[model samples]
Target: MKRTVLAIDIGSTKICALIAEIDDDNNAQIIGAGIAKAQGLRKGSITNIELASKSIKSALNDAKRVAGTELRSAIVTISGAYTKSLNSSGIVNIPNKEITLNEIQRVMHTSLYNANIPNEFEVLHALPYNFKVDDQDFIEDPLGMNAARLEVETHIITTQKSNLNNLRKAVKAAGVEVESVVLSGYASAIAVLNADEKELGAAVVDMGGNTSNIVIHSGHAIRYNDFLGVGSNHITNDLSMALHTPLHTADNVKITYGSLYAPSNDLIELPVIGDETSSHEVSLEVVHNVIYARVEETLMIIAQSIEKSGLKEHMGAGVVLTGGFTKIEGLRELAVAILDNMPVRLAKPTDVGGLFDTLRDPSYSGAVGLIKYLADGYTAYEIDVNRRMRHAGEESATHTGSLPEEAPKFEPIAPASSTPTSAAPTPPVKDEKIAESATMVNIGSNKPVQDDQPNPISKFWNWATQLF
Candidate 1:
C-alpha cells in the first residue's frame, strides 16, 4: 500500500501543511505543501472555531491540490501560552526475570499512574527520559534484558483541556480529522537539532512570532520546558509605537531592516509605506535600538528561565536556536551576549528527503519535524488508514494483553509497484524466511544499511510516539 502522511503545523500567525509519501522501506519523502494566513487564534489557542475551521480547510485544499491526492486526516501541531510541563517517576517489580515488551508497557503506565495533572489540564505527552533496572542506572532499553525491578522517569506535558478540545474541533470542522497533537517545541527540536547537540546536552529555543518555546535537554532527553509569552510580535509593537507608524508598517520595517545586536549610529531615510512621498530621514541606528530593546528583553527572560532549569550548568553544547524570529539578523549575537556560559547557533530542519529545498525556513521546522516524528514512529503494526481507524487500533492495543514488537528485518520493501500487487503471486515460503533473517542491503554497494539516529533516541521516540 502507498502510505501518505499529512502533517499540519498550526501557529498564531499561519498554518502550514506538508504531505509526504511513506515508502515500503519506511522512508518518507515530501510530496506536497500548503501555507495560509492563520485566523481565529490568538497566541496559539483558538478563540473563533468557525474562522479557524475555514483557515484549516483552505490550507489543506491547497495542499491536496499540489499533492494531487486528498487526505482526510492530519497529524497537527499545537502550542500556546497555556501549555505546561513537569517531571514524574514510577517504580515496579518485575514478575519475570527477563523484561518483556508487555512488562515495559506496564511499568511505563505505572509511572504516570499517580501523575497529578491539574483538573483543567490534559496530558499531551509523557516522554520517558530515564530508565533503571534494579541497581543499574540509565538503562536505555531493558526489554529482553534481565532485571528484577524497574524504575522510570518521564517528562509529562499538559495543556488546558478546553483549549485542546477547541483546537481539535476546529481541525475536525475543516473536514480533516486530527491524527495526533504534538507539542510545538519537541517537534521543532526533532527537525533542527543534530544527534550530537541532543546527546551532549543543549537547549533549543524556538522564538516564534507570538511565543518563544524553551526546552532544556540533558542525558539524551528533554528535562525541562518553558514558554515565554513575549515574542517577535512584541518587538514589532515596540517598533510601531516608537516610530509613530502603523503595525503593518512597523512589521515591514522589522523584516526589511531589523537588527538586534548592531550599532544604531548609522543614519538612513525611510518613507513610511503609506507616506512614500514624504520620506523621513531616520538612522538605521534608531531602527536598531527599538528592535534591540525588545529582543534583548526577550532573550534575558529566556536566559533566566534556563538558569532556573539548573540545566544551564550542564549545557556544554550551548544553545541551538530556530523558528521564524531567529531569522532576525544578529539575534544569535544578542543571545551570545546574554548567555555567556555557552555559544548560541542558528539552525533549521536538515536531513529531510524530497522537499528539503522548499521547506527550508526555520518557520517550517515544526511542520517538517512532525513528519520525521511520525515517520520514525512508523512500524509494521500501524495501518495507513483514517483517523477513526487509527483510534480503534490504539484502543484495541490498550485493551489487548501485549504490546507491539520491534520492527523485524524484512525483504527490502519491494519497489513501489506500478500495478496492483494485492493479489500478486506469493513469494516462495523459503524466500520469506531468508528475507526475515537477512540484513537489508543497499542495491549498488551491497552493504547493510542501519539507522543513523543513536539507538537510544530511536527507542524512546518509538515508545513516546505510540504512547502519546
Candidate 2:
C-alpha cells in the first residue's frame, strides 16, 4: 500500500501544509496543499499561541479536505535569528582495532558534548560533515575499516528549547502531531537542490516576511547556517515611509510598481491619502527606489553570510532563491547583480498528484520538500528491510555484521501448487540456491536508479521528469 506524509512550513508570513504520497518509483506525489497568512509570528519566532494555533488548524483542515483523509502527524519547518551554527570536532578510540558502525556513532556522540546550552536550548540536528579513521580522512562511512582511532567533524544546529516547546504545543492544539522539525532553508534544499549542487556547494536562501533563513551545503553536507532579521516586510515599511502613504495603500502600490531595475522614463504615480483618495501622484521612480533599496540590503546580508562560510570561491552551483517575496518582479535580476556572477535561479516544487496545478509556486518549496524528504526516508527503510530478509534466508550468508549477507532469502512456507504434474519439482536447497549464489552480484545495485541532473534545467522540471 502507498504511504502518505504531511509537511508543514511555519514561516514568518505564512503557514503552508502539503500532503504527499510516495509512488513505487520513489517519487513524492503531492495530494494536497494549504497556505494561510501567518499571525502571531514575528521575525520567524512564535509570539502568540492563540493566533498561531488558529493558523495551523486552518491550514491542516484545508489539507485534510483535499487529501480526503485525516492527517495526524506532519514534518514542520523552523527558523529564527537566534539559531546559531558551529563546526565541532570529535574523536573516539576504537578498542576493537576495527572502526565499526558503533564506533563511528560513539565518535559522533562525543563531538556534540557541549555544556554551554543554558538549559533553555537543545540540539535540533547534528550532521556529520566528514569522518576519519586513523590518519585517513573524508570517509563517508567508516564501518569495517581497520583503524584504532575514529574521528568526525559535525555541524551542530541548536534552537531554543522553549521556542520549540511552544511550537509543539501550538501544533498539538491544532489537532495534529509534529513528526519532526526541519530548518526552513534545509527543507527548501531538500526539495529544490540536486545531488551535484549539494556536492559542489550551494547556498539556499528562504526569503520570508520578516526573516531570511540561510543554509550552506558542500560535498552533500551542510557546513553553516544563519538567519538574517530582514525580509519583504522591510520593503513594505520603506514604501510606507517614502511615499507618506498608509501601510495598506503603500503595500498595494509597492506590489504594483516595484522594480529592482531603474526605469528610463522614471515616471510613477500613487494616490495620496485623503478623502475619497484625492488625486495625488507619486513618482514611479521614488517607489521603485524605495523597494529596490531594501531588497538590495537583504541580498547584501545574504552575500555576507556566504562569504563568512569561507566557501564563496568553492560554490559550484551558486545560489538558489525561494519564498513568497521572490515572486515579485525583477528580484531575480537583482539577485544576480548581488551574487557575484554565480548562477542564480528561482526554485519551485514539483511532482504532485492532486491540486498540483495550483501548488507550483516557489513559495511552497519548503512544504513540498518536507514531503519529498519524508518519502525518501521511508523508501530507504523499506529497501533495508528487504535486504535483511534476503540475508537471513541465504545458505552462504556471511556472519559478519556488515550489512545482511543475501538480501533476505525466502523459503517456501506453503505446500505445492494445486496443478498436477507427472514429476514433482524438487525444492532448491544448498548449492542449488540461485538467490544465495547471485547475492553478491546485485547486492549494492538495489537502490532506485537516479539519472544525472543538468544545471541549466530548472529544478521543478528535474523533479517532475525524474520520477518517470
Candidate 3:
C-alpha cells in the first residue's frame, strides 16, 4: 500500500513543511515542500502563538499548493532545548518460552514505566538499545527466540509539558493535527547516519541558524543528546556588532566571506546599519576573526557535550556534522582540531528521491528526517496510553489463543509513590491490526496555556523601524 506523509520542522530562523509519498517498501518520494521565515520564536520555544501559527500556516499552505492536495496531519519536529534523557531497564518473564512481538512491546513498555520521569515532563521516546535473553546479552532482536526471561535497556527522551503544549497549540492553530513529535537531533541522525555509523557508534551535530542540536548514536539507537543555544546566526550578530553593519548585511558577509582558515589581506565593503546609502570597507581578516571566534566556541561546546555524555569512547565512527552552519569553510578541519582529533565527516540527507534537490541541503535535515522517521516506523513498538486501553477492551472479547499451561501471568511493577502512577496497565493479548501501526504514546496533561499577548509581529516591526 502507498500513502502520503507530512512533516513540519519549526526552527528559530525558518519553518519547513514537506509532503511525501511512501511506497510499499517504505521509500519516500518528495511531492511538495514549503519554507517560510520564522517569527515569534526564540531558541526553539514559541514566544507568540499567533505569529508562530501564521508562520506554520504559510509553510503548510505553500506545500499544499505545490502538491495539489490538502494535508491535515503531520509528524512535527521538536527542539532539544527543553528535553531530558535517561536510561532504564525492564525485564519480563516469558510464559510461553517463545519471544514474540507482544513480548517485545511489553518489555519496552515496562522499561518506560520503570523510568522515574519527572512530573513536569512527558515521555517522547522509549528506544530500546539493548536486549538480554536470560544470561545471553547484547541481543539486538529476540523475537521468536526461546528464552525464560527477557530484559531490555532503553533510552528515554522527555520534554517539558508546557513547552510541548505550546508547540502543539501552534501546529493545531495551523489546521494540522500532530501525528507524532520527534526530537530535532534524533531526526537529523536518522536522515544522515549510515548503518556502519549507527552500529559502530557516531555523534551528529545539526547546526542551525540559532540553535545546534547534538545526538550520539551507538548500538543501533541514540545514547545521548544535548542542545546548544548558539548557532551560525551568532556569527552574523558578532559581525554586525564588530563591523557596524546592518544585520542583513552582516549575514550576507558571513555567508560570502566567513571562514575559519588563515585569513587574507583582501578588503570588502559592507553596508552601514543606519546609512544604507553609505558603505564602509572592512578587512577580510577582521571578518574571518569574528566568524572564527564564534565557530570555535560552538565547536568547543559540542566537544564538551560529547565528553560529558560518557559515550565518547564508544564512538568508533567519530563525529558527523550537518546543518546550515556546517557549510562554512574549514568547519570540518576546525572540528577535528577542536573535537579532540576525532574524525569528522560533513553529511546531508541521503536516500531521498523525487523533487529532492532543495531538500538535499544540510539545512533541511530535520525536515527530511521527519519523513524518513514516519516511513520507517522508528517507534513501532511504543505503547500509547489511550490505544492500550482501547486495545485491551477489544482484545478481551476477541482474543481466544491459549497460553502455555505452565506459563505465569505477566504484570508491570508499579512505581514506589504514594500517589498512583499514570503508566499504562499490563499489556493485553495480541491484536494483529493494532500491532502494525502502534507508534504514538500520548502521556502529557491536557491543559492549554492561554495566549493573551498583543501582536508580536507588529511589535517586532515597530522596534525595527525605531532602530533603523
Candidate 4:
C-alpha cells in the first residue's frame, strides 16, 4: 500500500537527491531532498572515483538525515551525449482472441529484439507509445480489447554500457541498489507536460550543465529524443573567454547578468572580481549578443535534430523547458525569436506534492520526475557491459610487470631409511622464505595505479559522460 523511492539526478555542476513516499491513494510526495556540489567529474562522467563517491555519499547522507532512514534502492536519472534513441515496432498474433498484459510486455521486448546496437551500447528504456489492435489504430492500451493481431510502436533509449556501469558502481558503493536509470530529459517531459500538451504535440529541451536534451512528445509518447554535448556550461565558458575572466567569476556574472533577450540600449558598469576598486563596464547589447549566439546555436541544433525525426512541424503545443539554465531572464523571448515565434514555457516538476516549495524549482525537475516514472509501473532495460573492452585499471592488473605465482606447498620427504627409495629428498626449502615470497606476490596483485599518471579507463569513461 505504501512505497519509498529515492531518485537522484547526477549532473556536471551539481547532484540532486530526492526521497519520495508513494501510495495509490495519495499518488506521490517528496519527503526529503538534498543538493551537493559535484567534484571529480566532467560533462557528467566520474573522473575521480573517490571524489565522486564522496559527493554522492554526502548528498545521500543529507537526504537520509531528512527522511530519517537509509535508502536501499534508488531510481536514478542519467543523461549524457552517450544516450541514444530509436523507434521500433513489433507485431504479435492474438491467439487467445483478446489482448492481455502479457502480450504488451512481449511486444515491447520484441521491439528490443529488433534493436540493432553494438556491444558497447545498452538499452535503458523500451517504452511503448502507440498501439494498434487489428482495425483499431492509435490505441494506447489494447488490453481487454478483442483483436486478432496486436502491434505496438516503442521508443527505445540506450546509452554506452561502460558509462552506465561506472555510474552504477559509484552509486552502489554508497550502499544503494541502482534500481532504474531513466533518461533525465524523458523524466522532465513526463513531469512537466500535461495531457493537452502531449495530445497536441510538444517538445521539452532540458538544458543542464553539460548536456541539453531534446525530447519531442506527440500522441502522448516520446516521438524524438537526442542530446547536445554542449549546454549552459559552454555558454559560461564562452563568457569566461570573451570577457577575460576566471571561470568561477564568469559563472556568477552569467547567472547575474545573462539574458537571451535584448534589454534597454544602455551600458552598466559593474565591479570586476579579483580587484578592489576597478570596475568593468560592458554594453548590455554585447552581453545579450554573446548569450544569444550560443543559445541560438543550441536551439538550431535541436531544430535540425527534430527536423531529421520529422517532428519539427508537429510541435503544436510548442516547446517547454526544464533545467537550471531556463532561469535566465528573457530566455523565453530569445527562444521565440530564434524558433520562428514558437510558444515556449518554463516548467518544473508537477502533479506531485510534499516539500512542494523546495522542489518547485526548474532545476529539480529531472530528479523529481524520476519518482513519478518509477511509481507509475515501468521497466528498466539494463545495459550489459560485462564483456566490454577492459578498463585501464583492470588491464593494468595483468600487465603490471609479471607477478610471481605462489610457490606450491611441499612436505618434508621421509628419510631414505637405508632403502635408497627416493634419491634422499633434497633439504626442504625454508618456510619463512616461501611465506615472504607469497606476501610479495599478494602485494603486487593489489597494487593501485598511481594518481599522478593518466588513466586510460577514465579516458574511455569521459568520452561518453555527456549524458542527460
Candidate 5:
C-alpha cells in the first residue's frame, strides 16, 4: 500500500509544508510543497500563537491544493533554540544468555530513565550511538547474540516543554495534528549528511533567517547541539541601519551585492527609509563591509560552538553548512577560514522524484528531512513511553509474565543502496544445528536470520553502516 506523508518546517522567515508519497521501499516522492512568509516568530520561537497558526495554515492550504489531498497529520520541525542534549549510558544483564529485542529496548530505556531530565523539558529523541555486548565493543546489533551483559550509550535530545506546547498549539490551530517533532538541526543533518560523514563524524550548521542551529553527528547520532540567536537577517538589519535604507530595500541590496570576497567600489541606488520618492546611492564596499561583519561574527560563534561541543576532535569530515543563510556568496570559503581551516561544504537536500524542483534549495532541507525521517524509520531504537505505558496497562489486566509474542523489528540505520537487487530467491540456512546454536541477526530484517543464512555477513555489514 502507498502511504502519504506531510512535513512542515516553521522558521522565523518562512513556513514550509511538504506532501509526499512513500513507497514500500521507503522512498519519498514529492507531490506538493507550500511556503508562506513567517509571522509571530522571533529567533525561531513562536511569539504569537494566532499569527503563527495563520502562517502554518496558509502553507498547508497551498500544499493541499497542489497535491489534491487532505493532510490530517504531519511531522514538524522545531528550532534548536528550544532544545538541549546530553549523553548517557546504561548496562543490563542478559538473564537468558541471549540478546533479544526486549533486552535492547530495556537497556535503552534504562539510559533514558537515568538521565533525570528536567521537568520543564520533554524528550524528543533518544538515539543509541554505541552498543556493547559482554567484553565486545561497538557491537552494531546484539540481537540473537550469546551475551551475559549488554550496554548502550545514547544521545538524548530534549526540548523546552513551554515552547513545545506553543508549537503544538499553533499546528493544532492550523487544523493539522503534529505526529512528531524533530530538532531542526538534526533534520538538516539527516537531509544532507552522507554515510561516510556520519561514520567519520561531522558538524552541521543550519543558518536560518534569525537563528543558526548547530549539531554534531558522531558514532551514528547527534552527540551535541547548540543554537545562536543571530542569523542572515542580522546582516540585512545592519545594512538597513548603516545605509539608512528601508528594511526591504536593504534586503534586496544584500541579496544582489552581498559578498565577503571581491568587494567593489561600484555604487548602487537604494530607497531611503520612509521616503518612497527619495533615493540614495551607497558604495558597494559599504554594503560588503556590513555583511562581512555579521557573517564573520556568526561564523566565529559557530566555530566556538563546535569547539565547545568537545567533539571537534572526532569531526573528521569537518563541517557541513546548510540553510538559507548559507546561500550567501563566498560563505563556504569564509567558513573554512573561520572554522580553523577545517573542510567546509555547503549542502542541500538530496534529490528525489516528482515535484522536487523548489524543494532542492537549502532552505527546504528541514522540510525535506521530515519526510526522509519518516520513511527511514530513524527512531526505531527510540523508547516510546506512551507505548510502554499502554503495555503496562495491558500486562496489569492480563497478569502475564511473558513478553509480547511479536516485538517491533529494528530497521537499518543506513540509507538504502541505489543498486537493484537480483530476483533470485535467497537460499535457506543449511546447518540447522549451528543455526539454532548461534543465530546471526540483521537489524534491517524483521526476524533473525540463522548464521548459515545466505550473505549473513553482508547483512551485518550493512547494519553497521549508520544513518547519515
Candidate 6:
C-alpha cells in the first residue's frame, strides 16, 4: 500500500512535524518537515492552551506547505510531566499442550488487566518485554511449541486524560487526528538505540528545552521509564540569573559558549547586542561551570532512576543521549563524566530512505521514530490470529475437517474518543478490532533518583537478572 503518515513531535522547546510515505515494500521515506518554537508549555505540560495550539498550528502548516498535501491525521510524540510507567506480567496455560497465537494474545492481555489506573488516565503503550513459555525464556514467538504454561512480562506507560485530550484538541483544531501518541523517550530510543543495545539493556535520555525524559530498556524492551523536571531551560535560567542578563542573552550565550568542562584563566570577549562602545568579557570557565552544574545534577538524577529500576548497573549497551539539549557543545563528554562506567554517545536518527539528510539531525529523533513505528506494520493484536491458526493446524493433525471456520478477522478501529463532553464519555473500548491494536503500558513509578553511573556490564546483568 502507498501510505502517507504525518508525525508530530510536540516538545517543550519546539513543535516538529513530518510527512512521510510508506512504500509497498514498507520503507518509510520522509517527504516533508517543519519546526516551530514552542510557547506556553513547560516541561512537557500545557500551561496555555491557546499558545500551545498556535505553536502546533504553525508547525502543521509548515509541514503542509512542504508536503504540498493536506493531512488528516498524525502520529504524535508525548513526554514530560504527567507521564508514568510500570511493569506487569501475564500468564496463560497452553491450551491442549499446543502453543497458539490466540493463547499468546490471551496471556498478554491477562498481563495488561493488572495495570489499574484512575479513569482520568489512559494507557499510551504496553510493550512486551519478552515471553517465557514453560521455563524457556526470551521466546520471541511461540506459535507451535509444546508448553504447559506461558508467562509474559510487559511495560506499560500512561498519561493524564486531560493532557492527552488537550493535545488531541489542538491537533484536531489544526485539522488532524492523532493516529497515535508515543512517549518522546520511547521514540528517541527507537531512533537511536540499536538491536544489541536494546537486547543487552540501555538507557536513553532526551534533553529538550524544558524537560528531560529518561527511558530504561532491558532485555531488548522498556523495563523502567521516567522523566526529569529540569532540562536545558534550567541551565539557561541559571545563566540569566548569574550574569544578570536577559533570557535572550542567556540563550545566545549558552549556544555560543556552553560547555561541561572549561579551563581556568580562560577569558573570551564579545560585543553585547545594543551596547555602546564596550565589549563584554567573560571566562569560558564561568560558562562551563554553569553548564556543567545543571547537566551533571540532571544526569545524576537520571542515573539514580536507573539504579532504582535496578537496571543501572546492567546497562551493557551504555547510554544514548538525544533531543535538542544534546546539541550543547561538550555535552556528550559531560554525559560520559557523570554517567561513570558506561559508554556514552549522542544519538541521531538514521536509515530513512528519502530526504534523509534533513531527518538525520538529533532534533528530529522523535519524528523519525514515530514514522519508523508506523512503517513497521505489526500491530499487537496480530498474535490472536497467528495463535488461532497454529492451534487449528495442530488440531487438524488429529482430526481432518479443514480446521474449524471459527478463526476471527482483524480490522482497525478509531481510538476511543478522549474528548471531554458535557457528560463523562470515556469508556473502556470493547470492540475487538481496537483490541487487536491495543497496547498497554504501565505507569508505576514516579521519576527515579541514581547516584553516579556504573559499569555497562553491570547495568546489563542487572536487567538480565530481572527478566527471569
Candidates in order have lDDT scores of 0.72, 0.68, 0.79, 0.69, 0.78, 0.70
Q: Give the range of the ten consecutive residues with the poorest summed lDDT in model 5.
A: 423-432
RMSD of each: 14.8, 16.8, 17.7, 20.0, 13.8, 15.8
Tens-place lDDT per residue, model 3, 71-160, is 888889988998888999887666557786666766766677678999999877777778899999989768789987789888888999
Clashing pairs in 4: 79-467, 79-468, 80-466, 80-467, 80-468, 81-466
Deviation from native of the Cα of residue 195 in model 2, angstroms: 1.5
- Residue 237 in candidate 6, Cα distance off native in Å: 1.2
lDDT of 1 by residue, 58-138 (tens): 889888888999888889888846888777876655544566554455455555555777899877776677889998887
Off by over 4 Å in 3: 377-468
With candidate 2 superimposed using the best TM-score fit, by how many Å does residue 87's alpha carbon deviate from the native?
Answer: 2.0
- How far out, in Å, is residue 312 in model 5? 0.9
Give per-residue CA lDDT, model 5, range 1-468, as digits (tens): 679999999887999999999887677888988899999888888899999999999999999999999978988888887687888987766655778666665677677767869999998888877889988887766768998778988888888999989999999999999877888888888888898898899998889999989888886767888989988889989999999998988899888887789888998888888886899888998988889989999999998888889999999999999998988999989989888899999999877668468888998888887888767735335543121311212222122223333222221222236223421122112222221112123212433445566465566767777532
Provide the TM-score for each candidate, comma-separated. Answer: 0.79, 0.76, 0.83, 0.76, 0.82, 0.78
Model 4 lowest lDDT segment of ten: 383-392
Number of the predicted model whose lDDT against the real structure is largest: 3
| lDDT (tens digit, per residue) of candidate 6 on 214-315 | 888777667788888877889889887766566787888898777555556667665554563566777777777888888888888877877778887668
Q: What is the RMSD of candidate 3?
A: 17.7
